[model samples]
Target chain A: MKVQISGLCKKYDGKPVLNIDNLTFEQGRIHVIIGPNGSGKSTLVNIISGLEKADHGTVAYGSNQKRFEEVRGSITLVMQHPYLFNTTVFSNIAYGLRCRGADKKQTELLVKEAAEKVNLSAFLTRKAATLSGGEMQRVALARALVLKPELLLLDEATANLDPESIGIIERVIRDFQTATGATVVFITHNIFQARRIAERVYLMMGGRIIEEGSKEKTFGNPESRITREFLRGELIF
Target chain B: MDNITNGFFGALELILSGNREVYGIIGLSLVVSFVSVIISMFFSVPLGIVIGMNRFPFRKAVIMIINTLMGLPPVIAGLVVYLLLSRSGPLGYLRMLHTPQAMVIAQVLLVSPIIIGVTLAGVKDRGNLIQKTAFTLGANRCQALWTIIKECRTSIGASLVAGYGRAISEVGAVMLVGGNIKGHTRVMTTAIVLETNMGNFDQAIAIGIVLLVLFFILNILLQKYQGA
Candidate 1:
């Protein structure tokens, strides 16, 4: 449940996006990464989750220091814009289970449990295509949660949600973290969301982790000007 | 002008009365077109998906060939089939010339490329998102393919309808291969041709009306299937 990333760098079309030296996420903790758009927060998450390859770096997991292929099954990523299958909500949540060869009974139970966890049990039979943006994000969360991965990655997972839905999602996420004690890495541009969810904060700027500490220190007493400006909502690129 | 009106109404009356000749032509046309469409679906849909989803050497060349075949003249296809199945030809031993089976074979060849080309375009356009999402969900190759197929079901339906329309309306290939044999291979298109040449405008128009209605019905079904 521990991940250590070092010397991670990525480039697209010869332009560098993410260039990180070292960072670590402890088990049973919520880590939030905050930055402006195009600051490479998403790129870092993508590289860690095995969604994209790093040009140079090593992402080691646990005491044995396993690589991505060895630890991929233990990590799940929910992208910024959740992609739902053109099927019922029940099927969408049950997809991960089905992929892992869960039987019909197990699949139904897990889907229902995950739906209830996310407060979406009432909409299980509805067509996924007809759901609102917030509902879709909940479905995505339910899908990831049902897998019970060791590390969960969220990329602006609640950005499109209404306040009510956002609150519900936040509570569900907090409860899941408390109950399962899994590591969570969340990315957001919303400063308040980071403040609300994260125990530890990593302030990223220009693809590097500029500041890292407890959420109270990073948000309350910033050391970097970039961090100061970002917290005050003055940083604009 | 008077003849046209009489022919149209007479055809409608024949349809209502269940005239055996009209029924025979209609039934034969349906069988030929349906069989051709089934065969085309079997080959073309998978071919289209594979071409759309994977890349290989000469993939573009293969696609270009299929696209070229989509616009192939029906008469040219007929001529080719006629040559292959004619007596003393390579496949002449099967004695399939002037039979409904020969017509089905010709129509299958004529319409398969159309189905493949159109379905390829549809599959390629929608494949990326489905692939990305399915892979992220840990779907292996086969599962990813099934997901893409499910997502592109509407496009597949459209391709099938287009193939059916082309197969049923085509007179040249069916006429050449089937030879308009009465009660055996006399499909609507061929019957219409034969009746018109024999100065029987009423029967020709009757078959033509049936063809038009069949096309309309197929299109309606396709629309409903896609909308669903």
Candidate 2:
């Protein structure tokens, strides 16, 4: 679903973490939000997913412009650190479906499909906590994907993954977006990765979106001087 | 040595022969403690999850209060329950004082804070990830809390075991409120107390043996549940 956020502000201990004036994400597009470390990219996506509340803001989702609670089940977020429930991979994948009271046959089928997508089918019976970092992340992705959320928010999901693992996750996510026409909000520090994955891009700094445009204009010929300096790695944000 | 051996045999015989008094005491003790723990769990588990996972004003102070209550002396707990149920007290019209129900209420008062305190400690280490994830994945508040409780099942189970230990071994509170009346509120602990006071050491030792055996069986069941 299309998401528009306006006047968003969040603070931690009186220090503002996110302060966005207005940002719009088109439905069925891959939107990458790039920022330096601690640039509030996660906070922005978290606010969209209602994982974190904005001190002052309005989040409009879809054509209806409904609140977060109204469109609650259609959004999902995967954090930087992999959070797999300390259970078998199968149960972790099935937890969402179970919580929503899905039937046995459907839950099994969806979990199986999701596992196949993330290539975690073989490890379904394995304890989730025993998996390696990359494997655990894959399990988390599978768990979220099984829910078939309309808006998937991934915050630095591939930050620490090996290139091979990153490639696998990216491939599955791209396939998912193409197949379901879901909105994918990806936050990353790598501009090249953004250029590779994003149809539209927003660059944030100091709790605000300093630059935003298509991939070519923002990454190749940005208007903002800070964006230019940030691209050149000459300025520390 | 003679008294010890004789007492041991007497205890064994009393248990083996299935005396009604011994059985009744065992049964009542189990019922009262179980009811109390169940009651405590219903309130404390949810309260603990809410407090441990949410940020609110004076949250630390509330946690401090719960922690302090976990260490509340048993007699003090009994005194509170006693006053609430006594004939001259506000709830005196209920006429529940000295009944098995009163014992359950007293034990619940003594152990609910322990349950909430330990559960809070357990959930405090979980760091809100489960609740956030669950909510994002289409879970309501109840479902999210259930997710947290399930994730920390081991810790919650340990908290329950601790509460049970406290409830079963209690004496001062139950005696004060339950009145330790013969054949009615006389549980294992109170039976042992009465037997000892009347200089019936053999019978007291017998009840003590029964209590130990009861503990072993119950703990085994608990371990099985935890393992499952």
Taking chain A of candidate 1, what TM-score results? 0.97
lDDT of 2 at B202: 70
Query: What DockQ do you compute for every candidate structure?
Result: 0.39, 0.66
Worst 10 residues of 2 chain B by lDDT: B219-228
| Model 2, TM vs. native | 0.93
Model 2 DockQ class: medium
Each model's lDDT:
0.87, 0.87
Cα lDDT tens digits, model 2, A1-237, are 999888988999999998888889989989998878888988888889887788998999998898888888888888888678888999999988998899999999999999998888899999998888888888889888898989999999988788877888889889999999999999988776787899888888888899999888998899999889888883321
Second chain TM-score for model 1: 0.93
lDDT for B43 (candidate 2): 93
Question: What clash pairs does model 2 have?
Answer: none
Among the candidates, what TM-score does chain A have in each? 0.97, 0.96
Candidate that would win on lDDT: 1
Task: Give, for candidate 2 chain A, the lowest lDDT window spanning 10 residues.
Answer: A228-237
**For all candidates, what are the clash counts?**
0, 0
